[model samples]
Target: MTADTAVLPTLLTALRLPSIARNWKRIAEIADRDDWPAARLLATLLEIEVADRTSRRIQRHRDQSGLPAGKTFATFDFNVATGVRKNHLLALGTGDGWIETGDNLLIFGESGTGKSHAVAAIGDALIDAGRRVLFTRTTDMVQRLQSARRDLALAATLDKLDKYDLIILDDLSYVRKDQAETSVLFELISHRYERHSIAITANQPFSAWGDVFPDPAMTVASIDRLVHHATIIEMNGESYRKRVAVARVKGKDSASDN
Candidate 1:
């Protein structure tokens, strides 16, 4: 029995995280009496369980290019736990319990209304619940689609969107998409419409989607499908970055006086 073999049982009990505890063998190998850095790093890494969980999330979205590393709705103020529900904003978007039933959703708000964060949090929750999720910016997705097309895998790539439980397109309208890209995007949205779920964070309103897709008909079709069984969440607030900047400035001034 090696030293790790001896403490494996106890270490498992320490964190009470069975999934992480399973890594005891490796953790023990690097945990030497003098290697505090290595030991602490390993411990902290496993303790968060992010190492294990994030991989699963990434794998799920690898097909659809799902959620970001650790985004979730729980991190924001409008969490369902204590959020104010105003379907008026999302009325056109929400389609009969879709939000609660893993259907599509769209969050359109000006800079810093917590729109992206809220949806990201939801994506995180989906991951935690063992649901497939992928998060990417519109520009990133279009680029990815373009790459897949070059490899002659565009159809395969769009189909993958159906595999994911949820997909989040963050910051749409960053740039215009060509006809082919818009076609693939439309297919992707149509595939997820009423079938899977999607959450989009856009700085620009839907009225301006035409700028992204020069084809007027395609844009309307895509939006129609996306909003059909979806919920639209509109948030209007000051920039979060600006608020943080103000707070930091106040702290600096206070320090100078002391």
Candidate 2:
């Protein structure tokens, strides 16, 4: 290799061009073999670096998103979720359009009705579209915020969370009406109100949400904030898992009869 070639990696590193540093040599060989002009070679090299950097950033965001890697829209069974508006959900899932407006998504359904799956699918889509998202169970996130509050670091934690464009809080019905925990959750909601986006999945309707928050007034306030600018999706149908289980049982029974 020439002295110039030997120094390319060091210069790329010094210039903080990681992708270019790793692949420039190999790409240069192709460029030289094709007798490419200097401008074309530079453009191609920079383009690869740009694309590679974007891919890496997406992967990093995906890793931090708390969403299951494989839970994508393609894997979801939209046929089972008839009440959900596929196009509307898809438009929201594309990232930042609704979130930029600080709107919320309130997903309502019974257990096993694919509510969590649907939210995760949307989160997966958003993350792939170069948006940051965080998925957490309602109780878990509350507990985290509660701990932060105890440590007097609640503000810092909330500040850190502001980096995410969307926060998916699953199973809103499961959190107990404990003051300490619910207060933190309420604070989170109030803090993010009209500022950022949140997608929540719940097994109960609004009329029953008072049971989830201790103070009746707090419950009303929470619901008001969440619903004020929210797109509510109701999946009121038989559980998908139950139907699949029943079908399997019927299939086994028919086989035995045969």
Candidate 1: count of backbone clashes, pairs at least 3 residues apart or interchain: 15
Using all chains and alpha carbons, the TM-scores for the candidates as numbered come to 0.66, 0.94
lDDT of 1 by residue, 1-258 (tens): 879668866877796666666665565555654465765857664665776666755565444544554444334554321222533323322233554455667787777667666776666655545566678887778778878888999788878666666777888867576545655667667656677777888878989998877588988988888877666667776666677799999999999999
Candidate 1 residue-wise lDDT at 108? 77
Tell me the whole-model lDDT of each prediction, alpha carbons only. 0.67, 0.88
Cα lDDT tens digits for candidate 2, 63-143 = 888896677789888887867878877887886558887889999988988899899999988887888899999888998
- Give the root-mean-square deviation of each candidate in angstroms: 9.9, 1.7
| Candidate 1 C-alpha error for residue 189, in Å | 1.3
Lowest summed lDDT over 10 consecutive residues: which window, candidate 1?
A: 86-95
> In angstroms, how far off is 23's CA in candidate 1?
14
* Candidate 1 positional error at 255, Å: 1.3
Candidate 2 global lDDT = 0.88
Clashing residue pairs, backbone N/CA/C < 3 A, model 2:
none
